[model samples]
Target chain A: MDYYDIVMDSCSFPSGFEHALGFKRVFVSGRDFEPANTDKGEDAKGRLAIGHSSKNLLHAARRFAVAVVPMNLGLDRAFIETLRENSTILIIPLSVTYGASSDFALSTNMHLASKMLAYANKRKVRVGFATMARSFEHMESYMQLIELAKLIGASEDEARQGISLAGDLFGK
Target chain B: MKTKFRYVLVRSTTSLGTIDEHEFSKGLMHYIGATNYFKANPRVVKNIDGNSFIMKVSLSGYSALIVALALMKHVSGKECGFFTIYASGTLKALGKHIGTPGTETHSKSSNDVDNFANNNNI
Candidate 1:
């Protein structure tokens, strides 16, 4: 099965990187909001936005075709259900976690990522895992992504599906 | 029962140059800790190319190693990223994907790593 990773814009991937990374497609996000690969046939109605707050996330979901909320804290069942209602997605991004320069930062980031993931799974929220890498150093291969997914408590099958969720967001 | 290891085929953005198994072990230990390191028993089997290599890690350490590989942003001050291409139970099985003419035998470090892991397990 094919897998995808959403990355921030770069000049371009290295030669043969797509094949080397084992991803059928790598969509680039032009900004922190909606990535450039999103279905653009629809105009402003489908703009993608990323929000950090429940209210802001809900607002973005209603204002745009797609709304992304980073999962970094303990979330209540009600808030997640409300996000599901608005069709918002919660994402655990590697960019935020891997930049940790200290052990404490890395541990904290890992705990938050895992907590968010476990909660999202329990809530059956549409959750995603992506590199969201702004640089090649931050980007990971499809298999590595799957491995990380498993590290964070996802089954092998669930991990594969999580990586592809970003592609689904791009409307592929 | 003999201890088995999973061989991981990986590629890097930049040439690894002189970086060896010891360096990989240190980096991984920093992330997963020495305990998980023994569980993983990761050894750099050999460099398939300047940028790609085969790694031998225990199944228990596979996930942690992968995450450590991703978490590692640099080596000796040079920026790089490691991408896992494939993994298999045996070196013979992994060599088929590496496209080498024949299976590469286990390196000395591989044997040492296995003994170390076996000793620790016991």
Candidate 2:
């Protein structure tokens, strides 16, 4: 069985052991979002229930040997340029929401974001999806985001290969 | 020696109209848990000419700071995103690309800006 790496706010950590078991990796980072297990400081599994930085996430990605991690990819020319230059850290960028109906909004729409990711993949960058899910009920959004990445431009074989790579890196 | 920070120029894409610099700056500080940093240190949000703003942060924390800003989905029910425009070790270097307030001139096209940004970062 394979599990996904889920990034969420600290306060929304799984309600119980069963809920926690559903994910392979969980990263809870947000100042306004507090941790669920306030008393223990760490969860039952010894994972800290606190906020952290992108550097922490990067370290996690490195430790798991995952080629790509889902994160907020900035649209700024310099930031994007820096990203293209690094090439080592692959990221699946989050969609930029610009109000409900702006050209910026349209370009950052989920469909278009996936298309952009597809184009990036063609350039040999190991892109991954980091769709934010507020709660377990948001699984639908997560699935849709992944499906968007998998279905666009990627061949069936390529999709399967990517999955295999993810499993090899993250699976227990 | 005076402390130096990694200067970043950020463009706000989601605000419906012009951004309220004071409120947005406060929100940004809270979002990044820099409230104490703000209280202790001087405010770094300089050259708040329009939608774009320049900020100075600890050099080591630059990427993490950008990530924190990038993770924000909504603020007070308004959907928004922070796009990084330029980052440099010095405000002077960043000002070269973005220009100083009241003397601003954007010389490059959007596509060219992207290319320039991409080529120079690594």
Candidate 3:
């Protein structure tokens, strides 16, 4: 079953969106940093937790079958290992930065992303890459991203599935 | 031994209005030349619209052709970006979806186009 762990934004609960997307469950994170005025609740279909750092995200990972993480923060081995030990699927958002600022950024490193997937595969952890192509360069970045994923561990079919999954989740 | 190739449908967006087709083609070749992906020039598939076109590129085990198309930044001395509208393992699927062929005389060589479009990558 498809699952999501969307970081909460200020003007919305994100709970309703989970229903709209037809996901089995949507775990809302980054809410611990929000003001107390924000609503909180949990039921059989959805759950809202106080998530402020990588630790909280790992805590949530323990409960769900899959964990969705922002790549910037989830790249740490500790965070990845937490989910890996639980056998939780790791769905990482893959964003490729370009131009002057991106030359030194680790987030845009295709080789790094590929190695992470390979590591996950070696540990028997199910992993997925979520990508959104905002421009042509971003599209190229995604091509590199998926190709690298295949080079490391993911098969061609798995790479295609990752692309389709990203399109469905982000409407890219 | 035979080599298999992949065909990519790249949709370009430009800031300087309609770009010259020849320049666009040349820019792509130049951009690919800078990368270690492929050493040869890819075949230019006919342009479907002012901004979108198709190209046949050699498949070298990975999505190198698509990756090259994605990295293109400038064509004809103007800034531009190429977005992938659709990528498939078959030309028939792309032709059916885009409602256009690789050539203007599409009706005559529809079979040939289908044959050429049949690449093993998606």
Instruction: State which candidate, 1 or 3, has the greater DockQ.
Output: 1
Residue B81 shift from truth in candidate 1, angstroms: 1.1
Task: Determine which window of 10 residues in candidate 2 chain A has minimal summed lDDT.
Answer: A43-52
Residue-wise lDDT of candidate 1 within A2-60, one digit each (tens)?
78887777625665566657787777766434442222222324655443454554445
Model 1 lDDT at residue A170: 72
User: How does chain A of every candidate compare to the true chain A by TM-score?
Assistant: 0.80, 0.45, 0.49
User: B2-119, model 2: which lDDT tens digit per residue?
Assistant: 5656777665544324545566656566545675444323234554444455666776555445544554445555655454556677555665655333223345333343454456
Q: Where does candidate 1 chain B have its weakest 10-residue lDDT segment?
A: B99-108
Tell me the deviation in Å of residue B116 in model 1: 22
Interface RMSD of 1: 5.0
After superposition, candidate 2 runs with Cα above 4 Å error: A1-172, B14-17, B34-44, B99-122
DockQ of 2: 0.01
Using lDDT as the measure, the top candidate is 1
Query: Candidate 3 chain B, which ten residues in sequence have the lowest lDDT sum?
Result: B99-108
Each prediction's DockQ against the real complex: 0.40, 0.01, 0.18
Top candidate on DockQ is 1
Per-residue accuracy of model 1 over B1-122 as CA lDDT, tens digit each? 77767888877777767565567668878877887778888888767666777788988888788888878877766777787877887665555566322222344534543554466552
lDDT of 1 at B67: 82
